[model samples]
Target: MATGNETQVREFIFLGFFSLPNNPVVLFLAFLAAYLAIVTGNLMILVLVLVDSCLHSPMYFFLSHLSCLDICISTVILPKILVNFLRRRNTISYKQCLAQTFFLIGFAGCEPALMAVMAYDRYAAICRPLHYSLLMSKRMCIYLASAAWVWGFLDSAIHAALASQLSFCGVNEIPHIFCDVPPLLKIACSDTSVNELANHITSLFVGLFPVLFILLSYVCILASVLRIRSGSSRRKAFSTCTSHVIVVILCLGNGFLNYNRPSAGYSLEIDTLVSAMFCIVAPVLNPLIYSLRNKEVKGAFRKVLNKWTG
Candidate 1:
C-alpha cells in the first residue's frame, strides 16, 4: 500500500536535448560517435592493463577499475537517451528511472575515490620510493578498489532510499536528458527539504572530500618533486601528475555544478551540457589523457600492439 506521502509515479517524460533547434540527425550521430568512442577507448584501456605485464601496477590497477566505472556510467545514461532519440519518445518507467539514478550515482561517486587512490599511488611512488612496492602491493590495491566500489554502493543506496520516499503527485516531466537527483526532485509533490539536505551533505562528502585529498596528495608530490636534484626528474614527475589533475578538475567542476545545489530556478539547458561533459567527455578523455601523457602506458600499448601484430 502507498503511504500518505508516497505516491507511485508511473512514468517520467524526459524533456531531452531536442528542446533546442538543432537537427535530430546531427545530434543523434554526434552522440552515437561519442558513445562508441567512450566504450572503445575505456575498453582498450582495460584490456591493455589486464594483458600487459608491464602495466600490472597499483596505478594501472586503479586505472582498470576506473575504466570499468566509466563504461558502466556511460551505459546507464547513454543507451536510454539513444533509444529516446531513435524512437522520438522520452518515456521511462518509474522503476527504470530509479534504477538508472542508482547506478549513475554509484559509478559517478566511485570515480573520485578511484582518482584519490591513484593519487596515493603516485605519492607512494614519488614520496616513498623505497616503500612503494610494500605500500601499494596487490592485496592493498585490491582492498582500495573494493573499498571504492563499496563506498559508491552505500552512497547510491542512501540516495535511492531518499528519492523513493518522495511523493510525485503530478508533473512527471524531467527537465534534463537523464534522470538526475535535482531534476527529479524538482517535480516532487511533497516537501523535499530532507532529500535536498541529504543530497547537499552527501555531495559535499562525496565530491569535495576526495578532491581535497587529491589536491593534498599533489601538494606533497609537488614538494617532493621540487626537492629532486635533477631537472629532468622534476619535469617527469610533473608530467605524470598533470593527467590526473586534469581529470580531477573536469570531474569535480561538473559534479559540483550539477549536484551541489537547490533545485530552485535550475537551468535545464546548462545542466544537460554540464552533465554531458562528465558523463560523456570525461570517460573518453581519461584513457587518452593517460596514454598521451604517461610514458609507461604509452609504452605498454605499443608493446601490446607490436606483439599482437607480430
Candidate 2:
C-alpha cells in the first residue's frame, strides 16, 4: 500500500499556545489550577447528588450525569494541554490524537443531549406534576441517561472512523489546540469531502436538534411557571429551573462560538481562545453556576460538611 513519494504522518505538531506571548510555565500553572477546580467542583456535585437523600429525584439525577460529563470532557483535553505546556512542545502521536478526538467528541456530544433530558425532566416536574412520577420513573431516568451516553459515543465513532481513513501525506501540523476533526481535515492531503459531509450532517442532527429540544422545553416551562397562581409557588418553580437555564446557555453558547467560526476564520490566537473556553472554561463554570445558584445544592454540601466535622 505504499504510494510514491508519500510518507505517513505518525504524529502531529500542535501550533496552539506555543506561539503566544505568555510564558509556557505560567500557562501550565493557570490551566493546572483550572483543571483541579473543575475536578473538585464537579466531584462535589457528584458526591452530593449520590449521598444526599433529598437529591434522589430525577432533576438531581440528571445533574449528577452532567457533572460527570463536565469532568470527563475536561479530562479528555486538559491533561494533554498540561503535558504539552510542561514539555515545551505541543505534539501528539497519530494514535493518541485519534483517541483524544474520539473521547473528546464523545463526552462533549453527550452534554447537549443530557441537558435536553434534564430540560424534559424539568418540564415534566413543572408542566405535569401529577404525572411526574410516572413520566420520570427511576427506570425511565436510567434509560434516558443510557441513551444520551450511547448517542454521544456512536456519533463520535463515526467521526473517528472517518478521520482515521484520512491520508495526511506527511502533513501533520494541526492549526488548532486539540485533535478536532475540522483542523485535521484542513491539514489532510487526501479527499475530505466525506469527512466534511459527515461533520455537517452530524452538526445538524446531533448539535442543532438537542438545542432546539431544550429551547422548546424551556418555552413550555416558562408558560407553566407563569400559570402558577401563588407568587411564592411561581418563584419556587422559577428558582429550580434557573440554574439549568444558565448552564444550558453557557455550554451551548460556547459550543456555537467554537464550531461556527466565520468562514474566513479568526486569527490563531482567537481560535485557540475559543477552543480553550469551550473545552476548559465551560467545565469549570458548570459546577460553579449550579453551586452558587441552587440553594438545594448548597444545603446538600453544608449537610455533608457538617457531618464530616461532627
Candidate 3:
C-alpha cells in the first residue's frame, strides 16, 4: 500500500552544531561551560529564593518558579545536544524526538506567560503600592502560576497529538539541531495543511498574545512611574522595572523573530541560532540579570552564600 513518494522513517538524524570542519573538543568544552553556568546560576537563584525570608514576596516567588522552569528547559534539550557533540553520531529516536518537541513547546510557551505575570506583579507593586500585597496575594500568585503551567501542558498536548497523527513516511533528516514542528512537518508524507494552520493560530495565541499583555502591563507601569512626585521614588521605581524590561526585550524580541511570521521559506541556519537563544541563552541570562542587577537578590545571595559556607 505504500506510494512511490512515501517511505517509512523511524529515526531522525540531527545536523548538530559544528557540521563544518572544526575542533570538536573545543566546541564541547565551550558548550559544557555554558551549560554548567546555566545550571549553577539558575539553581543558586532557586535555592536563594526558597531559603531567604525576605525573598518570599510575589516577585521572588515568580522568579524562583522561572528559575525552576529554566532548569527543566535546559535539561530537556542541552544534555542530549552535548552528548551528541561528544559522540560522533547525532541520532535521536522517534519517541525521543517527539518527547523533546513536546517539552520544548510546553516550556517555550510557558515562558512568555510567566513573564507577563511578572510584569503584572510589577505593575501592581509600582502603580498601586498600597494595595500591592492585597492584589498579588498568595492565592492569586498560585493561581496565575497554575494557569501558566496548565495552559502550557494543554498547548503542548494538542500540538504533539496533531504531530503524532501525521505519517512520517519520507526522509527523516531534520535540518535543525533538534526536533522542531516546522521541520518535522516538512517531511510528512500526508497533507500537513491542517497541522500548519493550527501551528500558526496556536503560535499567535501562545506567542503574541502573552507579549501584548506584557507590553500593555509595562506601558501602564511606565506611566505610573512617570507620575510619581518624588525624584527618589521615581528613580527607585524605574530601577526596579529595568531588569524585567531587559528580559522582556530579549525574550519577546527573539520570540517575535522566530514565531510571529509564517515558517514558509525560513532559513534553517538563522532558525537554529534563534532557537538556541530562546532555549539556552535566555534561561541562562535571566537569573544572572535579576541576581546581579537587583540589590534585593544580591542581598539574598549573600545571605544564602554565608549560611552555606559558614
Predicted model with the maximum lDDT: 2
Residue pairs with backbone atoms closer than 3 Å in model 3 (clashes): none
Clashes of each: 0, 0, 0
Off by over 4 Å in 1: 1-8, 261-266
Output the lDDT of residue 299, model 3: 94
Give one digit per residue, the lDDT tens place, for model 1 in 1-310: 1356566678999875756665767777888899999999999899999998888888888889988988999899888878877887778888899999999999888877888888999899999999998999999999999988987878899989898877787568888888877778878887889887887788777777888899899899989999999999989878877887887787667667666645566566766676677678788888898888888888988998999899
RMSD of each: 2.0, 1.3, 2.2
Residue 166's lDDT in candidate 1: 71
TM-score of model 3 (CA atoms): 0.93
Q: Which is the leading candidate under TM-score?
A: 2
Pick by TM-score: 1 or 3, better one: 1
The TM-score measured for candidate 1 stands at 0.93
Between prediction 1 and prediction 2, the one with superior TM-score is 2
Question: Rank order by lDDT, top first?
Answer: 2, 1, 3
Q: lDDT for every model?
A: 0.83, 0.89, 0.81
